[model samples]
Target chain A: MLEPVMFTGGVYKHDLVMELVEDLGGYVLQKNVTQSEVILLLLVPKEDMEALKAIISDLRGELVRAPLAGTEVAVVTPTLAIHHLPHTACDIAEYLRRNGAKSNMIGLARGVGRETAQINEYESMLIDEHDAVVFIFGNFVECIRKKEFLYRNINIPVVVTGGPEIPKEELPYAFEYVPSVGRITHRAKKATELGTLDKIIESVGRALDRTRTDISKDPLTTSPPRVMDAVREQVPEVEYSFSPLPIALNLNGVRIKLPYDKHKDAVRAVKFDEGVTLGEVATIRPSKMKDYILVRILPMSETGFVF
Target chain B: MDPMEVFKVEIAGEEFGAKKYREIIMDILQDLGLIRSIGRLYVYVDVKKPVFAVYGLLRTGIPPLLVRDVADVAQAQGGFQIKVNDEEHMSDLLKVLWAKYGRERVEQPSRDVVVVATDTSPSDLPVADLEAEFRQDLTDALLRIAPEGFRNRRNEMTDKSFFFIAAEDTLKSELISEVKEKIRSMENA
Candidate 1:
């Protein structure tokens, strides 16, 4: 088992952690540097956790389990207007990021109102790309229950949040219904409010776990992190992409931030240790999020082998 | 410990919605500084019909802000010297003075001090109409308090009270009367 963890330490000697992870046959999924501090998201071998812990302790760094790391979760709202933004949507997205998930905030253009709420084909397609999606709804129970169509066609797990608690049976389409987080004008400072945010993070974690279980049955030919590493080594130009994180990991795939048309051939031509090209093991296509390239690794059933 | 004399929110069949909207309304009104101006506030939301309404009685008679209210008007040689106490309305005061006494006559030597070259006292000059400003802010707060989807709106503002209604669908006379009757009953209760 590979344990997903986040390492927070000073910029000095952060390369040691990355080197250790690589030496242990683990993948350093992401490296973020903010001024003098550096944050690394790594998938380390569960048995070799103590070795990493010793080095982190020696460096006076902090290590915590980031369950949602390596997965992209969408923080969706009805709209980006004053009704849903800067409060519920922003708070949930920030909370997800704190838990180590690369959360994306998506505001539906026409998703509003009790009777007039809608999610267009393009909006649902965008949300479907994420591993899990949390839909932020308002206080009204009827509106919450009526907005089920928004996620009805979504292939990924849906975690619906609202003010009132409705029975799980009422929202059969949603994977989970997290209640008590609705519309508000202020930041989440109160204990109960922060508790709700924690609950959302927990729900998203569970949703991601469910997707992981589904993927485990028909496992991908290669793990997303391995593919990410291979692609980073082969397609060095991906580092030049203006996206803060050049490659974003999803449950079944990784979203390369470079333009699809420009980088598709270079990405497809990437080589692996088993003498197989990336084009043979994964489907490279245009991502719904921006013009980035989405690489969904083919399952073992299709590839007839696993690295 | 409510700020207003009577503050009530009623949402049919949605107790949580009622409580949450109460906070939302208070937060928005307080943000816009319209809380103290409202004496009594009643909010009704029927999500089934999906209509939202706010009826509030405002504190009467907020006189216009005069130059003297925001500044100290002193008798100075060749002009009446004004020392601004509140810089928030300094620009408004400057505009009012410049419009009345041409820009050449209004000499702002310092940031907070203004000298108006006029024979009459500049103390009584209106710096801002508080009543109009309050109404404008109150209207803005009401629009924010209502749900974003509630595009169709009706606002009836009088000298002492204001009644605002918003809905996703068209605002018809029958719905208006029905909401008025409901608010009136809440008032009587």
Candidate 2:
């Protein structure tokens, strides 16, 4: 099994850590360099953890389990209006990022008001790109209950947060409902307020885990990290794309930052060591986000092979 | 302790919502410095009916800020040299000076100094209408304190009190009465 872990150490000799993981048949998911320090999110093989730990200690690095690593989550609010942003939404997004998930904040254009709250087709499709989504609602129960249509069509797990403690059955469309985190004018600093944030993180973790279990039923023909590695090696143009993370990894797929039209053929033509092209194992399509290319690895049931 | 002499919030069926909105109201009011201006406050929210109402008694008698209140005014050789003590109201003071003594006669040699060539004392001139500004800020705080979903709004303000209500659908007279009655009962309780 590949254990998800995060490594925090100096920038110097970080390549040695990456080389060790590559040699151990593991994947380096993300590398974030902030000045002199470096943070790497990796999926290391469980049995060989001792080797990586020894190397990390020698380099004076820190390694901790990152359960939400290798997955992207979307933090959604009603609108970008002053009422919903800068306090609650930002706190939730930052908290999720601290737990190793790459969180993206999405503000719905017309997602305000009780009876008038709505989610358009484009907004829904954009949120669907992430592994899971958390919809931040207001204090009122009627408004939260009335806003169920926002996530009814979303395929990924939807974690709903609001102020009132409504029963789980009240929100059937939501995978999990976390209460006591409604609108606020100030930052979350109190112990109770911080506890609410932790609850949200836990709910999201459970939601992601549920999706993980379902995906395991019919495993993808090839892992998304393997595809990410192949694309990175074959498509050199992706490096100059100006995106911090040129290829964003998802639970089932990876979003290549390169434009779909120009890089479609090059990405499809990417070859693996098993003598199969990437196009044979995954579906490459235009992403709803920023004209990027999305690749979803086909399940073994459909592709009839796993390698 | 409540900053206002009397502050109350009532929400139907959602005790947590009521408590949370109380904190949110205080936070926004305190952030905008509107808490002291409000003497008594009553907030009533009916989530099922989907209406938000705020009726508050105001602590009026906020005097308009005069040039003398914010600065030291003295007669100079050419005209009046106003030395601003509070830079926060410097822009307001400058606009008043420019309007009183035309742009040519008013000169800002430095950040804190404003020279105006005029026979009349500019100290008596009003620099800012703080009462009006307070009302504007209170209105903004009301809009923020109400849920974002409550789009349709009505605000009735006087020197002594302000009544504000917001709802999802087109507000009706009957709904206004219902909100008023709910707030009245909360005050009584």
Please name the candidate that would achieve the greatest lDDT relative to the true structure. Answer: 1
TM-score of each: 0.97, 0.95
- Give residue B54's lDDT in candidate 2 (0 to 100): 96
The per-residue C-alpha lDDT of model 2 at residue A253 equals 90
lDDT of 2 by residue, A1-307 (tens): 9999999999999999999999999999888899999999999999999999999999999999988888899999999888998999999999998888889999999898777888999999999999999999988787789889999999999999998889999899999999888888899999999999999899999999998899899998989889999999999998898887889989999999999999999999999999999999999999999889999999999989998
**What DockQ does each candidate score versus the true complex, computed on alpha carbons?**
0.86, 0.71
Model 2, C-alpha of B103: deviation from truth (Å)? 1.0
Model 1, A1-307: lDDT tens per residue?
8999999999999899999999998988888899999999999999999999999999999999998989999988988998898988999998888788999999898888878888889898999999999999999888988889989999999999999989999999998999989898999999999999999999899989888898899999998998899989999998887888899998888999988889999999999989999999999999988898999999999999998
Off by over 4 Å in 2: none
| CA lDDT for candidate 1 | 0.92
Candidate 1 ranges beyond 4 A from true positions: none
Cα lDDT over the full model 2: 0.91
Candidate 1 lDDT score at position A265: 98
